[model samples]
Target: MLLYGSTDSGHSYKIRAFLLLTASPHAYQWIDLALPQSHRLAAFVAASKFGEVPVLLDQGQAMCQSNAILMYLAQRVGKLAGAETEWQGVLEWLSWESNRIGFSLPNLRYALRWSAQPPEVLHYLRQRVLADLARLDAAVSAQDFLLPSGPSIADLSCSAYLFWLDQVGIDESAYPHLQRWLARLRALPHWQHPDLAMQAVAPDTSLARDE
Candidate 1:
């Protein structure tokens, strides 16, 4: 298997984290949109929906989209993303993660990074972000894990953003369940990506406290 991605992207981090955690012995090939590369070639474009990072080539077939790639690997390894016995919490949480975590939270982070929006709009978005965090803190506090009482794609999916939000000075400690859950995820050996630690992306404490 060949994984093509950029180092600075959170979506790319998802795939990288799984590779470490699951100990999948696959070759990782990285590409950068910041440079002129074949990652934008017709062949690569044919393999993905948006020609974005986190595209996987498994057995010579290409798969794009980070969540899709994670799910595929999970099913193959008989893990979180694969076959579940029922229409239960796993599906619900997985779906929730795709939108609630992957899209909204990540976008907020990016917006803050390049926030040309009016100050009022940025403030509003921050409030929305806080609300989302509270909801997630509540959900995780209600259960030990998102599904089946252990790690799942849902946990990977959701926690990645929660951890990211925490890095951004979102003050996740107010959510006891979330803080504990984050500690558990952080404790995993596979999460030891040298360049991807919260310290690397954590919001500047000085800047965050100014508000």
Candidate 2:
């Protein structure tokens, strides 16, 4: 299996974490978004319909989108996919994450780290992020994971970008339950920090940062 991704992308990190947690055998290729499209690997360019990273190639088949890849991996490995009855809940949480926390947190991080946004825009993103964090904290307060079954792809998807809370200037300490959940995830066997998991060839520093 071959995975194409970028080190700085939380979306990419989601797959990396899942692969590590499952101890799946695979090779990772770091795609430099800074380079011109023509300069990128032809296989990656052809595989990524949206010109995005976190694309997975296995047995001559290609998969795109982070959440989709997660679901595929979960089903393939028979782990982290949750029980048959809980599949709907898992899907719900994944959808929620994609629309809510997944959207706000990454955008806020980009605005802060890659490019500066207008004050009003930043404020809007921050408010959305805070609200999403509160929702997550409340959801996991009573349960050990997002679903009753246990840690599913939902948890992995939602928690992916959160490891970089400090980079985006969010005080992770403020969200106690969330922090605890993160700790639980960190304790999982074979878990590695995104930086270490996704590390690869350095990209050109002169180009604009990826979202």
Candidate 3:
């Protein structure tokens, strides 16, 4: 399998991190998005459908979307998404990532893009981020993970985003449960390390100044 992604992209990092953590021997080709060079390539678009990074090629078939790919590979290796009793728990958390965790993403990128913008303009994002942190904090408070006792695709889907959220100066301290959950995730043996995702983002002015 070959993965085409950028190290600076969290969406891509999620996929690469999983492959590495699982010790999956796959070839990775870094696609630079510095100028939208490869993104418009016909071959890439055809393979990835939407020409998105972190595209995975498995058995001559192309799969796009990081979460989808994660689910595919996890099942490929026999890792079940949830226990019999917690099936809906698994579904809910993953769905939450699609919208809830997703809202914080664009705001983060916008902050990185317009770092020179006024604090007032970024205030909305800060509020949104704080709200997300609160929601996630409450959700994970009772369980060691999204599920009560085990890690699943839900956790993997959320791991990279949460790591990036904290690094970007979201004031994780405001959410103690989130901080503790992050610490617990960091200690897991099969945990996917989020180095480039963390590195891809810098602490923005909101995190540095207002913080």
Judge candidate 3 against the unseen true structure and give its global Cα lDDT, from 0 to 1.
0.67
The residue-by-residue lDDT of candidate 2 on 1-211, one tens digit each, is 7788997898999998888898877777899888999999898899898999889887678889999999999998899999999999988988999999999999999999899999999999999999999999999999999988888899999999999999878888899999999999999999988888878855334321221
User: Tens digits of per-residue lDDT for model 3 on 29-71?
Assistant: 6655665655454555667677668788777788888788887
lDDT of 1: 0.65
CA shift at 211, candidate 3, in angstroms?
47
Candidate with the larger lDDT of 1 and 3: 3
**Residue 148 shift from truth in candidate 1, angstroms:** 3.5
- Which 10-residue window in model 3 sums to the lowest lDDT? 202-211
Which numbered prediction scores highest in lDDT against the true structure?
Answer: 2
**What's model 2's TM-score?**
0.93
Residue 132, model 2: lDDT of 95
Off by over 4 Å in 2: 201-211
What ranking of all candidate models by TM-score puts the best one first? 2, 1, 3
C-alpha TM-scores of all predictions? 0.79, 0.93, 0.78
Q: Distance from true position, residue 184, model 2, in Å?
A: 0.3
Model 2: lowest-lDDT 10 consecutive positions: 202-211
lDDT of each: 0.65, 0.89, 0.67
